[model samples]
Target: MEVMKVLHMNGGRGVTGMGDSSYANYSLVQQKVITMTKPITENAITQLYYSTLPKNLVIADLGCSSGPNTLFVVSELIKVVDQLRRKSGHDQSPEYQVFLNDLPGNDFNTIFKSLPSFQKKMRNQLGAGAGPCFFTGVPGSFYGRLFPSKTLHFVHSSYSLQWLSKVPEMVESNKGNIYMAQTSPPSVLRAYHAQFQADFSMFLECRAEELVLGGRMVLTFLGRRSEDPSSKECCYIWELLAIVLNEMVSKGLIEEEKMDFFNIPHYTPSPSEVKSEVQKE
Candidate 1:
């Protein structure tokens, strides 16, 4: 499958409140990741403001999925920068040009519909002193360039980098599995790692070209505690899903060939692996 064409979180609000499979309803885990990384995000923004203090701040949230969490991030960033301006006794806060980027298939309309209320809340909280904020949605993959050269001042992404641009081509022999697994051959593991390195390097290169000097980026994504590609921490959930799919195949509920052809375009790299790629870039 072409992941870029087909992969996206379930869009729109689901049946009942926050109980169904829609991304808006079922993204608690991603929200938690945003909360967990709050400190890092705040710190980066603080430093960026103190260092550059651009009169017009351009911030992009890459891989920003639909729902409250998307706007939550935008709100938090503005709050931090606004608070910093007040603390510094600056007479004028920087104007904000916020960009929300995700796959073209994302539910951008859902996010846009909430902007009026979000702007009203910001006005109530920050009053007339808050800088004017403009929002635009950029639809594309972050694995390639998505903005003009040296345009962004701050960039943030959480729980996104783990998604590969595509499934590694050499893993076709990885039958009975949809991801890296304990039973996967050494060659399969190598192929996955190579794909990650290439994709991540390109990601860094594109971001480097886009961010202005001294700009900051805080990225948080899934990673394993060990270098082992099939470590349980990274692969156990997929392994369980594979087990269920195998059972269905046994019962003739689904074709084995179909299962064999499927593989998730995701990879949870170890810290060292990520560090190496970053350094290379």
Candidate 2:
């Protein structure tokens, strides 16, 4: 499948708010991930504020998928900045320009609809001390440029970036598998790693041009603990998915040819692999 063209969260809320596949209903783990990484995120924001102290603070949340979590990041940032400004005896709170970004296919309307309530909550929480917060959505893949040069002060992405821009080329021979698997040949592992290196490098390079001096970025995504691409820690979930898919194929629910052509455009790189790419960029 062409991931960029076809892939998106099942947009909108679930019917009856129950057993449906909408991202809004199914993003608890993502929310927890955000909560888990809050310390790192807060520290980055704190450092950025201390270093630059821009009166007009600009923040971008790349892959800001629609749901309750959509504005959670913005709220957290506002709180951090507000406390900092108060402690520093700055009478004026920094005006905030928040850019919530995601793929074009994301259900941004849901996020838009929630803005009134979000603003109301902010008002109640911060009262008269809050600065104006303006939000706009930018739709595009972050693997390429999404903002103007030196326009962003802080960049954040959570539970995203594991998705590659596209499925790696030269994996057509990875039959009976939807991702790198223990049974796959060494070439398949190399292909996935190579794709991550290229994609992540481009992501860093683009962000470098967009961020202001001393800007901060915090990215949280799925990754492997082990160096092996096919290790169970990283590939086990995909392996289980492949099993279900093969079962469907056996029952004639999906065409074998289609299954053969399908491979998920996702990779969970190890820390060393990520460090290598960062150094290269």
Candidate 3:
């Protein structure tokens, strides 16, 4: 864990054109956010689910980008496993099978290269006496199942699920707009909202398929608590981006009318929405 923290001092897997995922590094900004609330969330996960992990636990982190933050989360699972084992009074601890998953376009190269060092750090921190822990990458969309049935004992993901598979197909120029552009003359917030719903629902279904019965998953994602359906809080981003694009048009730096309508392919589902989906799973 000491070594893991050391590695983290370095940042996030950068966003990819293919939407590449990189390893988490600690930017001053990122470290501040990490310190703000993750400890409480981690504690909750540990208290409730630590004892339930089976021996030889097959744990997987969905959307595990190659970054320092990923290490932090992975290390939590490792520590949790250790604590559980100590309580169970077993010298033979579960082997950790970590599956670092993300979109296919993810930088498998970075993950593969850095993973060796991560393993070495783990070995050094854990000691030769500690039970074996294995690391592997599963590259694919979290919107689909990337692992075998009932294989995962515990699952985790943070910050990635909010990303949709692609810009909504509806969002294109000269082609019928499947997505509402932030630049659309009147508005396309409704279209954006629809896409978020579709993507998030798909995410829930995919995860439900992969996790074991009674297994637990801890997820932290971008969201809001506002109850109004048409609140501007959600769409204000489009307004802001529109201001910038409008400037581009005024400067003649870009086409005045051709600004592809754009908005984040995201939505913060109500807590009730999340809980209801969990129940279905």
Candidate 4:
């Protein structure tokens, strides 16, 4: 038995991705959100770390993908748990409750399909669940309660919080100015700040509600070089993508009306900005 469990919970991760293009659109959206955490290494010495590191803990992963990527992370987390257990000096195996979570629209069926193989590998290596590993699939918005009160000891979310519910129509409309000049004009940057402020506040409130007191949360979100909340380069990726979309529209690849429809529900919060939000928790 694996006493402890590990998780990469991506709460409310798939909210921004919507519409008739549910398949490809979701992938693109997830990619954009995950890009923020590409450099993440999962430091073992964060403030949220355990003092003795419990050998038995319930772990949940939110916004987990539905393919090889998801399984790979699960394996890595399990490895972490294994390391923690070995130090405990107890030969007794721990019972693991691994929670794989995501949006209701996430490909849960596909994730389940790969579970048998994961279990097989774990059983061969450690000897736990039905065969050797205990695995569980939990589908829901991590933004709210994903588990019972104080049920989880450790939680992790990677490259998933940058997502906002959805970009407001008024902000994305053609009627609004969308230029970000490094010089005199600051409206674009100010608007961007306002947008981030709105979503970031929500993100903080939601996470605070889900996590129990003393429960640690590990998260990696898209960040920016500018300490200022109003940096023009903060969202240059989306701007570039918009330009590309316009090019496609000129070639009749997509409708011009959809230029406003193109949106990635992500916001790169600065360290200070994130710190301020965390203070509210």
- Whole-model Cα lDDT per candidate? 0.89, 0.89, 0.59, 0.55
Candidate 4 Cα misplacement greater than 4 A, ranges: 1-56, 128-133, 169-195, 228-234, 250-257
Residue 150, candidate 1: C-alpha displacement in angstroms: 0.2
Candidate with the larger lDDT of 2 and 4: 2
For residue 131, model 2's alpha carbon misses the true position, in angstroms, by 0.9
Between which residue pairs do clashes occur in model 2? none
- The alpha-carbon RMSD values of the candidates against the true structure, listed in the order shown, are 1.8, 1.8, 7.4, 8.4
**Higher-scoring candidate on TM-score, 3 or 4:** 3
Candidate 1: residue pairs that collide: none
Tell me model 3's lDDT, rounded to 2 decimals: 0.59
TM-score to true structure, per model: 0.96, 0.96, 0.75, 0.69
Residues 185-264 of candidate 3 have per-residue lDDT tens digits of 33344444555666677877776777777666767775657653334555566556667776877788867556644434
Write down the RMSD of candidate 2 (Cα, Å).
1.8
Per-residue error at 69 for model 2, in Å? 0.8
For 1-281, candidate 1 gives per-residue lDDT tens digits of 77787777777753222335778888889999899989989999999999998899999999998887888887998999998999899989899999999988988877887788888899999877889999999999999999999999999998889999999988358899999999988888998999999999999999999999999999999999998999898899999999999999999999999998788899999889998998898
lDDT of 4 at 210: 57
Model 1: residues with Cα > 4 Å off, grouped in runs:
14-19
Residue by residue across 1-281, what tens digits does model 4's lDDT show? 11012222222213232335444334555455444443342343222334534445556666665644565555665665565556655555455667777766566666676677677777676544211355677766554556765566556666666655445333334321223323313544555556667666765566566555566655766677787643566656555666777788889997766654444445677788788776866
Clashes of each: 0, 0, 19, 12
